[model samples]
Target chain A: MSDHLPSTARKPGLTSSAPSVVAAELDPPTPRKRKAPGPRHEDKRVAILRTAAQLFADNGYEATSLDKIADQLGMHKATLYHYVSNKESILYQCLVLSFGNLDAVMSEMEDRSVPPLQRLRQFAHSLALAQNNVFGRCLVLVGSRPLDMMPGGEIRQFQRRLDETVRALIVEGIADGSIKPCHPGLVSSMLFGSLNWVPRWYQEGGKLSIEQVVDSFMDVLTSGIAAPRR
Target chain B: MSDHLPSTARKPGLTSSAPSVVAAELDPPTPRKRKAPGPRHEDKRVAILRTAAQLFADNGYEATSLDKIADQLGMHKATLYHYVSNKESILYQCLVLSFGNLDAVMSEMEDRSVPPLQRLRQFAHSLALAQNNVFGRCLVLVGSRPLDMMPGGEIRQFQRRLDETVRALIVEGIADGSIKPCHPGLVSSMLFGSLNWVPRWYQEGGKLSIEQVVDSFMDVLTSGIAAPRR
Candidate 1:
């Protein structure tokens, strides 16, 4: 029972590892195999996370309470606590999920054997699509604020990784002559900022689709905003 | 007492011409004319606002209380409240101050006889400086959040004005054949996002000065990251 409970949602394993080992020894795992989380349980957990994320983005993280989230989801507070340890865990889950999607895009870029410029464009297109949704939008708008307040350095480390990945790509592009020579650091910040801002102004059910917006953004990024010299 | 309070800070006088007149008839003039706000009072008000802006930017607006701000300033909360109505007002003042500085730059650009491209460059330079400081940084970081939560629409109106100003500049640049033909709205969003992101990473005593960072950003915005054709 003690092994199952975490002190803080962020640092669940902070308590003695002895407790978990002792609990495992005492309980032999005979009937608990059937009690493990199933697909339905996982789906409910995801639903809670999705709802919490929208609430956090709509009302600020500090402004949002677990009670409000449960009420919004038409669930009891105890039921929400059953899935998530606390509000921070919900926030952490949302950010982790967002980072996972971005990492998947980065991995896709990495596996491709294309020119650096093409890789950059592909990354931009994928990022624009990712940011068009609520999860990605919250990651951008509320970015690092909620994480900065909570315990653990994982979120900040994730941010640094994202920065380094983009910066390295730009550097590679410049080295291969596929992209122009520019300060990679500044350019990465600019690129990420521009990409993240898409959901803020991108109108849903508007005339221009997400594809058009991403293309225009990529065009400005790649071809420059200045007209060609005569 | 009724005459002293305004309904909304942006449009304090919106409700009634009758209220002030009625209050004046009921009250006789007194020696309080000498207690009218002087330059010293105005300076104190500005100082309070400056401190509040820094606090709001560092810790979020909602998280920052008037009590904390007063404590930071070594004054009592009541004394601080005497200078401003509430935390929202402090945020509003910071935003208005930031907008005033940006507006001055825009006005200077308008007054100059330079070409539209030159004006755009100048505007970018001035914005970088303004944003590097506390007031402008708060305006960008806390941007429209507190204002949206408040009753007045002034901040949104201010945002629209800024959008119009930058969009018009881009339109002029394209017409003059200085800038490339692209969607002004998308380009403007990109440019502003990039500019607003400067304060996030710009170090005070780093190797590159503010001027260097601004120049590099402007260079990228103008020439872009793609290599020139032979």
Candidate 2:
């Protein structure tokens, strides 16, 4: 990412780059209404989540329907009501599943007394892992929504908690004099932003292991190899 | 962004940090959404772009609709047909407008035979500027859709063109011994991914200038601050 290798070259590297994105806070007119009733079933719940994630991934959240999801699962439309009450619930659940793992990773970091910088490396690894899963797209889509979803809501506050945790981690690093004192928010943004965007360009069965990618990212992100005196 | 800040006396200085989004593109949605064909055409066109961008940004491309857009605009459903024939057209226009300026930025950078590294700095700045606007969200939404709008579509070809362009730029620096020979794809992704996600966090009336953010990004991005010792 350094400057001045040359002004012109043979190929554009990441030039085709574009960002990509979910959910049921959408309000299109309903085509049909069905009575909401069903038993609390577990398999049905899992099926609903799995189906909704696909639909949400494919069609976006607002355009998907409980009926369509029900149809995909080969179940009655009303039967979906028993498993998940509304499309919004499905949206929230998909989000919870995606972001929930992030919280777990951070907590695990807390359990260790690793130095601040090492902890940051742990964050990069965990973040890459967390964002690379099925829940990754769900996380991107859900986070894109600009609505003031209830501040107290789990999804909304969950991000806040995560932000605080990341910031605290960065702060701890700075205080120990092991990290740079640049804006932690910007640093955090750069850190997670790099990880958050992995889902956009990364393919599942590709050349580099997740570990190699993490190391490369850390090399560029943390300690640039260009010696100042040189 | 260092790795060794200690854990004690965490006299946190980054607490006031608010994550700022240095997104990739931000444009008002394409002009006119009224499909019904009627009075105040100009107003209607801009209105459609406004509503559609919000919907697409919040919802997703396939999920947002002409009808929902009209409803958001407070215009009749049929009125939307006048401005755009369909959602796909709106998506294309929204994106084309977002990309329109990029071509200009590259051209501006071309006038001066700046060092390849400086050219990259200029590239990063222009990209960061594009993201600071309304079109950034538009790019993110439409960029995700897997569209084949034209027969023998060059979406694949255009992406190739873009890749070639970036690769050439990077290779120039490498050949000139100005930058290292790293994975161009990974570097490209890291630079863009970090820049594109800026909108998700940055507020319009924030403390930092676009250049400040850009330089900071380019600093950590291009050359890490770790001073080397003998």
lDDT winner: 1
Model 1 segments more than 4 A misplaced: A1-34, A225-230, B1-34, B108-113, B224-230
Error of 2 at B19 (Å): 30
Candidate 2 chain B has its poorest 10 consecutive residues by lDDT at B15-24
Q: Clashes in model 1: which pairs?
A: none
| Per-residue alpha-carbon lDDT of candidate 1 for residues A1-230, written as tens digits (9 for 90 to 100) | 22332333233122112222222222233443656555565677777877887887777787789989999999999988878778766676666555535665666666537866677778787677666666666677777675565556555776676678778788787776667777888888888777777777777799888888777777777665223434
- Docking quality band of candidate 1, CAPRI definitions: acceptable
Docking class of 2: acceptable
**lDDT (10s digit) by residue, model 1, range B64-167:** 89999999899999888777777766777676566545655655556536766667778878777777777778888888675565666666776676667777
Instruction: Give the TM-scores of the predictions, in the order they appear.
Output: 0.82, 0.70
Per-prediction DockQ: 0.48, 0.26
Model 2 residue A1 CA deviation in Å: 47
Taken over the whole model, the C-alpha lDDT of each candidate is 0.67, 0.59
Tens-digit lDDT string for candidate 2 (A117-224): 677778788778766666657666445362344232455566666667677877776676666666777777777777777776677789987777777777777664
Tens digits of per-residue lDDT for model 2 on B1-230?
11111121112111111111001112123356634323355455655665787687666666676778888888887777756666765665454444435555555455437776677778888677765655556675456353443333333343344445555566776676666666666766777777877876676678988788878878776675222322
